[model samples]
Target: MTIKPHALKKGDQIALVSPASRPHSAEALARAEAVVEKMGFKPIIAKHALSINGYLAGTDEERAQDIMDAFSSDSISGIFCLEGGFGSIKTLSHLDFSQIKKHPKIIMGSHENTCLLTAISNQASMVVFHGPNICSVDRVESIAEIKSTLASSTILPPVTPSLGSFPAGFHHTSYPGNAQGTLIGGNLNAIASLMGTKYSAHFNNKIIFFCERDERNDIIERWFTSFYLAGHLKRIAGIAFGEFPDCGPKDSLSMKSYQDILTERMIEHKIPSTFNMPIGDSSLSRVMPIGIKAKLDATNGKLEFTESALD
Candidate 1:
């Protein structure tokens, strides 16, 4: 399969579409617009970006139409999902993959956006980044990484683990081992929802998994169990668990408590895993290039790039 690489240039135009969840506040939407403006790209906001109906950005048809319009727009060099919620999957079937293939450009977002990213990667043979959404540019480091990546020529660098504390008791340490393979994963619930579907992200031997969790939701354990049952655990070579944003130990449980829950499962299956390397949804989260090759150094809790994602 021939992958069409979209070389992002400075001063290019990018459209922000809320294909999943709508912004919780007008301030959040403004922050996203501010991020795009600061990135040197002209930001185009779709009509549905501010339209909210429950958790979704809009109705399924509205969200899908915004996405299609963004891709079909000649002036837009890339499309960034504003934030992930729960409706991207509902609009996936309406996407015209062939049109996307013909007019290739970068489509990026993480969390629930994983389904769309993985499906496009497999079907369109394009490398889609699972990076921070516009709502997450509050952190200087993440914003810097995003800017550097989008402006860099021909390669994306690996992001080292950023150590920090969270109100919820976030923590990280090396696991004392290393593994390498193509990066494949996202929010556990997001990928889990694709199981048994034709759009499911395919994995094989030696795949380094990149997964993150959030505490505002209740489906963490459920999705983890689903991935295991769907045979992802058996096929993956190593795992990197990003900092679960707002998921530190609180109330009846601590961050360690939740980590313990997943650690026990990984150990039971003998799947090597690393925890709390910030990548998304954390103040210290790094920009990781999805659909690219990378190595996981569990001993030092570092993720190193094995090749140029732009290549």
Candidate 2:
């Protein structure tokens, strides 16, 4: 399916809706607004972006309406999820997929937002981004990725490598080979959530899967087991793992334990894998296009931009 690019213009209105976590203070919202305003686009908040109901931003019905309203509004050019925590999957069936498909717009977020972005793209055939959220990390690289993706006249190379230059806090590796395919993946838990669902992204020939999860101790083992058992990881040409945002220092297991779990899981499938490719809760994050074709070099441990993320 060909996706129409929803590129941003000078005065484009970007709707900020909370499809997930809603436990936000007034100060946090102000900061988010400031971040959006700094980018020069009008950031309009959904009425329930700050509503909190336990762990959810709002009721599934209310969140779904906010998303549907954004896409249905003629004045809005894009939908930017305010933040991701959980609950995106709960609101799925309530969304108007047909209306969103007819008036396609850029939908962007990461973490748990992965569920919504991937599901909508696969079901509606729209190009939703796996980039940073408004209240999420908006580093220089992340902003640049967003700008390039939403701009016209941008051309991506046929094959790209993950940018080299590891800082002291991070580690890297080399895959030594490359494969090309439509990029499809997000949070590991999110991908796992799509099992038995019609909205799951179809893994076809030569697809490169990028995934990450919150770094919870011993959880990686179960997550990867369920993910592979779901047949989501077996068909991909390559894999890239972003920072596990849920990893906490309180956990008894060391960082190496988490890495070992990932390695073991990939080795179980005998597929080449790359880890520590950056995207996470850190202030520094790179925004990767969700559905665009790109090269994953496990030898050099890099994911390069190959084509423009949008049509």
User: lDDT of each structure?
Assistant: 0.73, 0.71
lDDT tens digits by residue: candidate 2, 1-311: 74755678766888989999863677777777767666667888898999888899889999999999999999998888778888999999998888888988888888788889888887787767777777864465556556655754354442223344245434344233566677777777787777778877676644544556545656656766776777755776777777675564346554556667667766666555666766543445555566776777776665666666654
| Top model number, lDDT | 1
Once fitted onto the true fold, the runs of candidate 1 whose alpha carbons sit more than 4 angstroms away are 2-4, 25-27, 163-176, 206-213, 216-219, 248-256
Model 1, C-alpha of 231: deviation from truth (Å): 2.2
Q: What range of 10 consecutive residues in model 1 has the weakest lDDT sum?
A: 166-175
Model 2 poorest 10 in a row by lDDT = 156-165
Model 2 error, position 85 (Å): 1.5
Evaluated at residue 125, the lDDT of candidate 1 is 69
Residue-by-residue lDDT tens digits, candidate 1, 132-241:
77885677666666767766546555555554544333435324466777777777677778888988877665545456554522346656777778787778777887
